[model samples]
Target chain A: MSELAMHEIDRLKENLAERAAAEGLIDVSYRLVDSPVGQLMLAATGRGIVRVAFAAEDFDAVLDSLAEKVGVRVLHRAAPLDAAAMQLDEYFAHARTGFELNLDHRLSSGYRLEVQLALPRIEYGHTASYKAMAAVTGRPAAVRAVGTACATNPLPILVPCHRVLRSDGSLGGYLGGLDAKRALLSLEQDPFGN
Target chain B: MRLHGVKMKTNPPFELVVREHGPAVLRMCTALLRPGPDAQDAWSETFLAALRAYPGLEPGANVQAWLITIARRKAIDSLRARHPVPVDSLPEQAAPIDGFGPDGLFENAGLWDALGTLTELQRKVIGYHYLLGFPYAEIPGFLGGSAASLRRAAADGIKSLRKLLDVSEES
Candidate 1:
């Protein structure tokens, strides 16, 4: 603990802090998509998509939460999301229909999983009633349970929970709002028609 | 969001936790591995693994230390896979991260260099206590060492780092 030694530790701390900040910035980047709902920001690590936020969501809070959960400092930039955003853009444009990126599905499980798992089967230009999904999940009588699952789905669009409808063929519920679901269903009917 | 074993917090969203602490875990990976592209790979793998195992993370837990533990194991495995030597016989020099200045003493480089020379136990101790900003009390649970042992290890590691850097500067 000599003066020089202390100074060195101080220097190391400062250097470490600076490097951490720089690295965090370099590691995190976001892509914005003009979805039918609103602007969607996809935050990605070098490996894959880490977060997706709606336009009304608080960006800083979202970034902070992602960093804390993933145990990495989140750098806010417009770079890493280029690939994911592009894919989403294609999706929104109806040019591309599905995501090929690695997704961090840690935020979802249980009923959410059951619902998400059923989404792909809903097919393009097709929809299933909530009761139908419950039946598919072997909960043939748990139609209300299926509705809850759709409401809790973490990967909304990618999982295509919008395809779940009310037993009467009405749109049941969607995290992105019913209007967004309606728009998505419309787009699926006519990729270029939207 | 709502991880399986974790409780919902009215205080903050979980994504913020990932953003703030992710770099510390990455830094620990770089420190454990030799600097270079492989370190980056290890870091990526660590996060991917973390994402897969995220549901098990308990709320009010020390996420930074938890992540460091996982990353350390992954780094060791990555090192073992790339090298044919027995785990104990694996040379520190085998996975040298390219372009890293000696001991990471250079300001232009990342902190990984300085961390490379320490024993694995020391690295984890210091990583948990200092870089990731964990309290001394939490070190015992995260590292499975006694509180006193953890403190001593961190102190000794800091001393060792200073000495290592000193030697590097002189050379």
Candidate 2:
């Protein structure tokens, strides 16, 4: 039904995306990236990466929350997420250990955000107890709160929330399910073997 | 990274809507406003408006029809915003776009020129019905006329195009 050349449509979409960003009509840009874990939906604002969702998480529900919590101008454009996508690809390929990507922390706040921000310091291939996370956040008495923080982490793999374990060194709850948590930990422990 | 199977959602990302209907909307705008900043503005405005209101759209709403309605309104708004210089009194029109050559809508310059010769109603009728595949019965609501008159306009528009492009005698 389209008499316009395919390239013309593509060009128009590109132009619209650029114009939308220029006009601030685009607050959140997102796209799906496939990783070893599963299909990941990555979303970002002009500020930084805002939300990351595993396939197990209902993408529609995630999008609705982003619209409600962030802004209604979320688009499925990939430009803003290009860096995150590349880094994620490298991560899945075992070529990267730390994420140097810019993160927009607006989706989180208070103790939850504090716990999530401290997750990267746990070091790659190393696991930490929720008690340790609470201690790191200077809330040594809030071990349960630390667990809640890791459980509700908005950034997921990017924030390394899977690094947090129970005090007895047991695999704790993961938003992406236990298997995904195990897989990520194993990937970090022995990148080439798994 | 491995391409893991995606869990399907009944509600697709908004980009799919843009990709699906963008070209047709652009073509409609070109036919309605011709190739220029005006057409581009109408196109951009339509999609921006659509994107803002998308989350609240009814689950099974007719997406293309809804977009067409918005595009038509945006085109009308653009037309109204233009300075009312008489078509005959205006200076010779400059080239509409710089790089919209082989990659854009007016690659068939002759066809675009032919389309320009038709009356506004003829152009809209031809664009909505023939180019964008809008039902004949539905053309009236967007462009305003009975279906019967729109069908006549479509026929007359094509006749004019055939004559202007000099394909009638060959056939």
What stretches of model 2 exceed 4 Å from their correct place? Answer: A1-11, A191-194, B1-42, B49-70, B77-171
lDDT of 1 by residue, A141-165 (tens): 8877788777866556777788888
Distance from true position, residue A114, model 1, in Å? 2.9
TM-score of chain A of each: 0.74, 0.91
Tens-digit per-residue lDDT, B64-123, candidate 2 = 767866776686566546633222221112122222221233335556667778898998
Among these predictions, the greatest TM-score belongs to 2
lDDT of each: 0.61, 0.76
Model 2 agreement with the true structure over A14-118: per-residue lDDT tens digits: 777777777777868988998888899999988899999998998877876786677656677888898999998888888999899999999888988888888
Alpha-carbon lDDT of model 1: 0.61
